[model samples]
Target chain A: MVLIYIDHSEKEIKKSSHEAISYGAAIAKQLGCSAEALLLGTVNDDLTALGKLGASKVHQLNNESLNNFDAKVHASLIATAATNLNAEVIVFAHNINGKAIAPAVAVKLDAGIVTGACSLPDLQNGFEVTKTVFSGKAFAHIKIETPKKVIAINQNSFGIQNFEASATVVEMTLPIPAASVKVTNVNKIIGEIPLTEANLVVSGGRGLKGPENWGILLDLAKALGAATACSRPVSDSDWRPHHEHVGQTGIQIAPNLYIAIGISGAIQHLAGVNRSKTIVVINKDPEAPFFKAADYGVVGDAFEVVPALTAAISKMKHNE
Target chain B: MNILVCISKTPDTTAKIAFTEGNTKFDENGVQWIINPYDEWYSLVRAIEIKEKDPTTNIHLITVGGPEAEPIIRKALALGGDEAIRVNSNSNDSYVIAQQIAAIAKQGSYDLIMTGKETIDYNSACIGSMLSAILDLPYVSLANHLEVNGNTASVQREIEGGEETNEVILPMIISCQKGMAEQRIPNMRGIMAARTKPLKVVEPLATNAHTSIKEFSLPPSKTGVKLIAPDQMDELVKLLKEEAKVI
Candidate 1:
């Protein structure tokens, strides 16, 4: 069995879980085994429906103590389940939660592990997985030598594919160990879509001038129904909240479309969003290094270009 | 309280990334090295702040690398650590590196163990958790704000969208990130003092890595940017819709 750890928060499943499911299912097909999902925490989503994403079995591990993510607890439970089931492969979404837990789980199971894996393993020859290295600057194909293997798939890399099967929900019971670390408080950002979950992102930077000029960026984001982000300088200067910052030091996002406006393409900044599928850089400076990495470049001031682009998108939406 | 902080030496964030030896190894030529930002700016600084509050608290730094990592380790010591450890062996495998750190960490009776969430180079983000598992310690990762309160600690960790505060008692591991502390530069006095600090180089334990790198490849570069004039908003939108299909 290939056990996929389903990641969730606030009673909702993250899209990354779907990718993990699909990826696990693909790997299971390669290994001629079954794909199973392990979901913990307080998710309200229907567990059985997860089969559509690609799991033959969905294991729901629930306890009052499992309300918040405790890496130790999660790792222990996952390792136990993987062991009990004699799982050939274990999978995680490689999101924040996965990064925190997968390593420990691997160590517990004494399994060879690979994180940030971008593609499915090449099992024909051996258990080899390709993963991002050097902060998205390059890729490395890693061969896991251990019999039991764990892999955390990079988000937005392996896509979702519907598996025409209905998964049976397995009510898993594991005594939740007393957590040494307790979540004292949770302050969640409401209303706005989280940058991590956003498929489309509109980000701004120092070139936008100041906080007063941010209306145009927000307007564009609103028009496109996309999440808004800012550069490290913008967040550091208090022009935007720290959570909106995306860079090497801040939140890293891999949206389907990342529109970077007025942000100089510093390597630190690029490290965060370089994994984005299609990057659109709008800047007045033709020499800005960002243009070299951008798929679409607009040599114009964001002040004028953004509002106009927003209006065009809004108009196009209205026409549609 | 003794705190063990794990530090890593990585290429400067702004350095151009390239491969040498036929894409099998990182090209270190002309690359500037720095103490990974998360370790220097957050993990070590937060440790320093804790030690400042309780002067009795001791901070020990550890790095797993060859002699190339010594300068970076010294830079970390200059921040405020009392002593340091340099693992003699260096490998591309993170498991080997984490294993070496764990070996030294096991020898010390520490109330706290901290490390950067991930190195910018590999972005493995696993050392703290790996260490926690190897030592069977509780861990809270990506802590943006950490405060020591007696033997227990309060840490504000960055979650997916927001932040959550986690409380842990003594003898826990944590991975630090930005927003944990203000970055501090080593003053001339501290730099001079770092030279005299005790830096014990220990031989690596016999450990086998579970994974090995097969090969490396760079992402295909952008074919070329389709530059559009500022006034061509409609055309740009059309391209995004019809050509890119991302809008």
Candidate 2:
């Protein structure tokens, strides 16, 4: 059996989990096995609806403590579930949570684990999985020699596909481990589209000049319904919150469209956002390194060009 | 207080990646190795800061690699680590590396264990959490800020949209990221001190790697950029609308 770990936050299922389910389902189909999902905590989404993405069954351990992520506890629970099901392959979305727990689970099960997997395993001769290495600059094909295997798919690498199926949901009663950490306070920005989940992202760098000039970027982001991000230098300069920084040293996002304004595409910065489907760079410097990676490039001043683009988008929306 | 920082040696960011032996092995020729930026900049520096705050604290560096990795470990010591431990094994498998670190950590009874969020080379982001499981300690990954008070540590980590603050007790594991601490440069005086620092090489515990690399290949290079003049803003918008369809 192929088991997929469904990652959820605050009862809402994450977008990456859907992709993982589809990827796991495809793997199961390729291996001639059944695809199942494991949910550790209570989730609001209908488990049956998840079946459309391709799981035959959903095993849920509805424990309140499980809602808060503890790497040790989650690893133990998932390891138990994988063992109980006699899973040949286990899948996880290589998000923050999955990256934390997958290796521990791999250690517990003695499974050959591959994280940041970009493509499905080739089962023709041996189980070879291709994964991103060198911070997205290269790919390495890894082969697992162990009987049990664990694979964590990178976000946005595999698009989600839906099929016609109804998955049976089963509640599981397993021993829960004590959490080693406690939540003192959570300062979460409510109602903003997360960078990881956003299909469109508008990011800026020091080219915006200061925090006061951020209105133009916000206008463009609001008009496009996109999340806002910044370069590492911008965050370091305190022009934007550190959470908004997207680079090798910051949050890595794989949005469908990444619009970068005034940011010189440093190699470290490119390491984070290079996975975006379409890169649009707006910079006054024609020789900016980011232009080399952009799908579409516009050589212009951000102060003038961003406002014009925002106005044009607003007008386009008005016409609609 | 004893603090343990896990260090890794990785190729520099600008190093041209190439494979040898029918693309089955990483070509190490003409490659420059440095302490992984994440390890040196965040994890090791933060541990040093903690030691600075408490004069009684001792910071130790550890790595799982062959003799070539000793220079990287010594560089870490120059940045204020008290001692170094080298587990003599060179394996790309994260599980094996974690087991080795966990075994050493168990013997040391460290109050705090730290590592970078992930190495730039392999980018597994797994060693710290795996060590936590093996040691059965609290684990926090990608911690941006950390504050320790007595037995409890308050850590702020980035989530999707915002940040989550966690308070974990001592004997815990944390994977450091940016904002945890500032990067420190080693001075000549520190370099001299590092040369005298104790770097004990030990044999690794018997642990088998579960995974092996079949081959390596670089991502296809990007095609040359298509530039549109500033006056051709509408043309760019039209292309985005009709050609790319991302908007």
Candidate 3:
């Protein structure tokens, strides 16, 4: 059986996992096998709704203890689940949680692993897989010779292809190990899209001048319904929270579109966001390093250009 | 309380990457190695925080690499660790590296294991989770903030679209990222004291091998930027519609 690991937050399915499930179901179809799903933790949505994504069955370990992600415990339980189902191919969404647990599961199963995979495995040619290397700069084709294989599919690589089918929901009991890591209290800042998963992002830098001017950037981001990010200096200067920083020293992101206003791209900064599919730079400095990497560059004041762009986008959306 | 933080020696972020003669290994010549930045947050800073919370805490830095990795190990020691350990091995496979760490953690019977979410060199955030699996412990990844009280820890991790906070029990592994703690530089006195600290060097135990890298290559450089005239908004729109198709 081919197994897909469904990643969810607050019982709602993640966009990335939809792609993974589609990818897994496609692979299983190609192999002339059945596609199944394994969901860890509690989910609020209907389990059978997963059938729309491609899974024929949903194996749920609904223990509330599994709801909070503990990578070690997750890996152990996943390894056991894979063994129980006699899974030949294991698929995961190449997000933060998948990056942590997939390799560990591969180790437990003694299976060959491929991470950051951007395409379906070429099953006709020795089960070859392609993955992003150099921080999403290039692709490397790898083949796993081990009988059991693990693939962590990159986000946005595969489009979601939903099919109408009724999926049987099976509740299975697996040994839950005692957690070594204790959780005392949770402190979270609510009400902002995470930079990693945002489809559109608007980021700023020192050019914004000070923290007070941050509202302008936030305005543009809000207009586009995009996530807000900052250069390392902005965060270092306390203009933005450290989590909002995106660079080699900060969070590396690969989004559909990344727009920068008033930020000069350093090599470190580029390394983190270079994976973005499309880059748009609006900086007054014509010689800013960021312009060299941008697919579109406007050598004009961000104050002038951003408002115009925002207005144009809003107008286009309204017309649509 | 005894704490063990596993550190990895990695090429500095600024170093130019190159492959060996046969494209088999990452070229290390003339490359500067630093204590992996992620490890610095999850391991060293957290260890110091524990020591500050209780002055009796003993924190040790450990790495699985050759003698050449000592200076980087010493740098981590200077930051806050009480001592250091260098396992004589150089392997890129995550499983092998985790095996060495699990062996050390088991032998030391340490209460806590901390490491970076992923080493920047390979961008593989596997070791901590793999070690956790091997050691039969709970693990947290991408912890942007962490705090401990007694045997419980409250950690916040970056999730898709937002952040999630969890309360976990101790004797677990936590892979840290930014927002966990600010990076700290060793003081002059700490640097001087690090030179005298004890560093134990030992041979790595047998490793369970799994996979290998076939080759390494650089990414294709992005094309030069296309300049769109500020006043020619119509032309820019036409270009985006016809040429880029990103809009």
Candidate 4:
């Protein structure tokens, strides 16, 4: 069976998990097996809706203790569940949680794992999987010889398809191990889009000037319903929170469309976001390295160009 | 309060990455290495925090790499780790690295194993997890907030689209992400102290690697940006509809 991990926070389901279900289901169909879902912790959403994403059965471990992400305990529980269910293939969304948990689970099961998987397995060739390497700089085709396998699919790698019907929600139980590590306290970024799963992102850099001028980036981000990001310098300078930094030293992302404004594309920054499907750069410096890597470039000041772009977008919506 | 902070030496984020002949090896010719950024969060900061709380608490840094990685390891030491250990072996794969770390963690019986959420180079984020699995311990990944009390740990994590808090026991692995602790720079005293700290070198344990790098290559350069005149707002809209297809 193909088992997909449905990642959630609190009771709300993560959007990426839906994509994971779709991908897992398609793969299951290809393998001529049932695609089942394994949801940990307590979730408020209808577990049966996973059927729309191609799950035949949703195995939910709705324990209150499982709600918090304990990677060690989580891996142990998942390993036990996979073994009991006889799951040959396991899948997770290649987001923060998945990135952290998948490797541990792979170790527990002694399964060959592929992270940042961008496509379905090529089962024709010894279960070969294609995954992004070098921060989306390229792809490497990997073949897993192990009987068991784990794959963490990058968000937006597959489109979610809805089908008619409901999938069975089967509650299952696994032995939860006592946690060895204790969490002392937590400090979280107040409000912002989860960079890993954001589809559209508006990123700025040193060129944005002081943090006060950040309004331009935020304005553009709001207009496009996109998340806001910044270069390392912006974050280091405290123009934006460190969480908003997207670069090699910052958060690595693979958004669909990434707009870089007032940023000089250093290779470090590129390493973090080179996987983005489309890149738009706006900088007055014609020699800015980012322009070379952008699908679209505007040789203008972000201060003037961003407002114009936002206005144009709003006006276009009005005309529509 | 003994703490183990795991770190790795990886290619600097700004290095012009290239693959060796036939793509089997990563071209290290001109690549400058740096301490894996994640380790800075979970290892250095957490180590500093623990040190501040209890001056006697020792934070030791460890990595599985070659002699060339020593300088970067020193940089980590400079960051605040009391001492460092360099496992004398090339990090062939995550499993191999995990074995080395597991061996070290076992011998040390560290009260906690902390590292970054994931390394920027391999981008695996697997070591902490694998180590925990090998040790049969609980782990928390992508922890933004962490509270260590005696032997128990409670963490706030950003998973998926929201945040969830988890409480677990100690001697477990925790891979830190953003907000775990503030980034710190080594002061003069810390830098001087780091110079005098012990840096032990040990041979790596035997490992069975399950994966290998077949090749490395850069992504194709994007097409030059297309520009629309400043006043061509309507044209831009038309182009979005007819050309970009995003509208």
Query: What's model 1's lDDT at B88?
Result: 89
Say which candidate scores most in DockQ: 1
Alpha carbon lDDT of residue A128, candidate 2?
89
Query: What ordering of candidates by DockQ runs from best to worst?
Result: 1, 2, 3, 4
All candidates: TM-score: 0.98, 0.97, 0.92, 0.90
Q: Stretches of candidate 1 above 4 Å error?
A: none
Model 4 ranges off by over 4 Å:
A163-166, A175-192, B144-149, B152-156, B159-168, B178-197, B238-242
Model 1 chain A weakest 10-residue run by lDDT: A59-68
- Residue A254, model 1: Cα distance from true site in angstroms: 0.7
* TM-score of the second chain, cand. 3: 0.94
Over B1-247, each residue of candidate 4 has an lDDT whose tens digit, in order, gives 7888988887776666677778767788988887877788555787688788879788888988889988877777887788889999995578888989889888886878888877776676678778877887777777777777887767776654355677776767777876777776767876777777899999988777766555455556666677756556556556655675544
Weakest lDDT window of 10 consecutive positions for candidate 3 chain A = A180-189
Candidate 1 scores a C-alpha RMSD against the true structure in Å of 1.2
- In candidate 2, stretches whose alpha carbon ends up further than 4 angstroms from where it belongs are none
Tell me each candidate's i-RMS in Å. Answer: 1.0, 1.5, 2.6, 3.1
TM-score between model 3 and native: 0.92
lDDT of each: 0.90, 0.90, 0.81, 0.79
**Per-residue lDDT of model 4, residues A236-282, tens digit only:** 88888777888876688877788898899988788888877778788
lDDT of 2 by residue, A74-108 (tens): 89999999999999999999998899889888888
Residue clash pairs of candidate 3: A181-B168, A181-B169, A182-B153, A182-B168, A182-B169, A182-B170, A183-B167, A183-B168, A183-B169, B144-B180
Please give the DockQ score of every candidate, comma-separated: 0.84, 0.74, 0.45, 0.42
Task: Encode model 1's per-residue lDDT on B69-155: one tens digit a residue.
Answer: 999988998888899999888776777888898889889999999999899888888889888889888899988988888888898
